[model samples]
Target: MTNFQQSEALSRVQPSTTLAVTQKARELKAAGRDIISLGAGEPDFDTPDFIKDAAIQAIRDGKTKYTAVDGIPELKQAVATKFKRDNNLDYDLDQISIAPGGKAILYNALVATMNPGDEVIIPAPYWVSYPDMALLAGGKPVIVKADASNGFKLSPEALEAVITPKTKWLIFNSPSNPTGAAYTHNEIKALTDVLLRYPHVMVMSDDMYEHIVYDGFEFATPAEVEPALYDRTLTVNGASKAFAMTGWRIGFAGGPKPMIKAMAKVMSQSTSNPSSISQWASVAALNGDQSFLKERNDAFKERRDLVVSMLNQANGLTCATPEGAFYVYPSCEGVIGKATPNGVKISSDEDFAAALLEDEGVAIVFGAAFGLSPYFRVSYAAAIEQLEDACQRIQRFCASLT
Candidate 1:
C-alpha cells in the first residue's frame, strides 16, 4: 500500500479529540461492548417540528437552487433580526455572512485575516476547533488557561496579559465546549474593558451556547456589551446547538462590513453559501418560537446538575458547577499516580480517560486535548438514564483504583 501525505498546513492541526472519543465508543458499541459516550457535544433533542416543516416546505417549493455567495437575503435578514432582537445589536445585511457550520465561519474568517506571524489569543478549555482553526489559518494560537477554579472562565487580567503587537484576534466561546463555563455580565464587561484598550486585537465571540444557560443567568455577547469594540467583534451564532439542528449545516455571523465581505469572498471560493434548504430552515429557526429554547434548556440544566453531583461524588474526582451549557470539567488530580486493579498506573488526565474507557466502557475527552491537564470533559447531553449509568460507571472505575 502506498502512503498518502498530508499538506504541512493540515499537519499543523490535530483531529478533534471529542469526535475521536465518540468514534471510539461507536466502534466498541458496534462490537457489542457496552460503551457509554459522554464525548458528544450535540444536544440529544430533535429539531422542533416547525423548523422541520420549513425545510420540507422549501423543498416542496423547489427552492433548492444556488443562492447568494454568503446567504440568501431572507436568511440574512432573519439572522440580523435574531441579533437585534436577542443581543441588542444592530447589523445590516451587508454585515451578515453565513457558512456551512460555525466551524467554517470561524476558520474562513481566520484565513481571510491571518498572516504567518499573526497571533490569536484563545482561552483554554475552549471549544476544540478554535486553536486548531487558527493554526490551520497560519496564525499562532496563544492559549491562556482558564482552570476549573474560575469556573473555567478567563480573567480580564489574563486577557490583558496576552495582548501583543502581533495579536490579531481573540477567539472567545461562551458556555464553552467541554466546560459549560458561561461568563456573567460583569465578567464579560471586564474583558471588554480590556479589549477597549487594544484596538489592534479583534474578537470572535462564539455565542453558540447562549441559550443553554442555567439559574436565570443573563447571557451577554462582547459587542453588545461594548459598543466601542463592536466594529472589531464578530458575533457568531448558528442553529446547531440551541435549536438542536447540528446536522443542518447553517452558521451565520454579524460583524464589520469589511470583514463580513472578506469572509463572504472566502466562502465563495470554498463552500459557497451553505445548503439552500438549511438556510430556509435556519430563517424559520431564527424567527420562530424561541419559547421552546427555555424548555430544552430546562432539560439540559437538569442533566447538567445530575452529572455534576454524581461526578463530584466519585472518588478522586471534583466537578465544579457550571452556569450554563451541558458539559462538565472535572479534575482527576487526586487519582494521578494511583494504580488500577490491573496495575496500570494513572498519570495524566489522558491516562484516566483511557483506563476508564477500557475498564468501564465510559468515554470522555482528556484535558490535554483542550489545552489543560489533570482534568477531563463530560458532555452531559445524553438522556437522564444514560447519564446516570455513565456516572455510576465512572464512580466504579474510580473506586477500582488502588
Candidate 2:
C-alpha cells in the first residue's frame, strides 16, 4: 500500500475554524439541541431583490455559459466604476479581475505572485484564511501582533519591525474579520508611509466589509487613501459581506495591469471565472442603489452595542466595542485558569469555546484560530433576540466557572 499523504501546501493549511464551529453548531441543531451560533462571518440577510432579479434575468437571457477567464467584460467594468464612484480610485477593465469569492481572488493573486521562501507579513488576529493561503502558496507567514489596546490595529512601527528583504506581501484587512477593527484613513496612511520605504512589499487590501461600518465611520482602502501606493496595492472587495451575497461567489480586485494580468492567468488555469450569473448579480450590487447600507449598518451597530455591553457584564469575560463588521473579539483571560462546572479547566480560548459549545450550546471561533490567544470571536449577524439569547447563555456559562 502506498502512503497517501496530503500535499505539502494543503498539509500546511488549517481548515477555517470559523466555519468549523458554525458547522458543529449546525450538527447540534440538527440533533434537536438548542444551539446559538455566533461563528459565521457572513451577513444573515438575503441578497437584495435587485441583485437576485439580475441573476434571474441573466439566466432567462441564457447567460449561463463560462465567462472570460477572469470576469465578464460588464462585471469588470462595473467593478472599475465601483472603485471610482465609491472610493475615488480609477481603474480600467484590464486592471480588474474577478474570481469565485474574495478568498479565491486573494488566493489566486498570492499563488500567482508568491515564490517559495517568500515571507508574507500578516497582523495578528487576522482573517484565519490569510496565513493558510500564504502557506498554500509556498510562502512563509510572518505574524505581527495587534491587540485590543490599539483597537486591534497594527501600527507603522510594528509593521516596519517585521519587514525584511524576504518580505514580498503585506495583507491588510480593515473592518477586520474576527475583531471588527477598522482602521482610520490616517492610520492607513501612516502604515503606507512605512510601506513606501519597502517598495518590494505589495499590499493586498481586503475591503470585503466596506459598507458595514457604523457611527458614521468613513471607509477607506489603501490605494484610495494613498495614491503613491496605488501601483503596488491590490484593492480586493466583493459582494459577499456588504451585499449579503455570499453564495453568489463573486469577488473582484483592481490593481496594476501586470498584477491583475497575472491573477487572471492564475484564474484561467484554476477556476476559469466566477459564476457567470453571479457576476451579473455582483454588477448590480456594485452599481445599484447603496442606500440600504446605512440602515443595515445602523442595525448592526445596535446589535454590537447590545452584545458588547452584555458580554462585558458577564462574570469574567471582557469585550471590546468593535467599530465595524459583525463580530466582537473579546478577551477570556479572566476565565483562563478557572474550572468549568463540569471540571474542565479553561486554559486557552479554544478550550473555553469548546466547553461553551458543550455546555451552553453557543458556538464561537477561538482566537487561537486567528493567531491570537485568550480571546474568542462572536459574530452578531443573527437577529437581536438570538444575539440576546446567546449572550445570556454565555453569561450563564461564565457564571458556572470557578
Q: lDDT of all predictions, in order shown?
A: 0.92, 0.92
TM-score of 1: 0.98
By lDDT, the best candidate is: 2
Stretches of candidate 1 exceeding 4 Å from the true structure: 1-3
TM-score for each prediction? Answer: 0.98, 0.98
Model 2: how far residue 237 lies from native, Å: 0.3
Return the TM-score for candidate 2, rounded to 2 decimals. Answer: 0.98
| Weakest lDDT window of 10 consecutive positions for candidate 1 | 145-154
The positional error of residue 293 in candidate 2, measured at the CA in angstroms, is 1.3
- What global local distance difference test value does model 1 have? 0.92
Q: After superposition, how far is residue 279 of candidate 1 from its true place, in Å?
A: 0.5
Residue 210 Cα positional deviation in candidate 1, in Å, after optimal superposition: 0.5
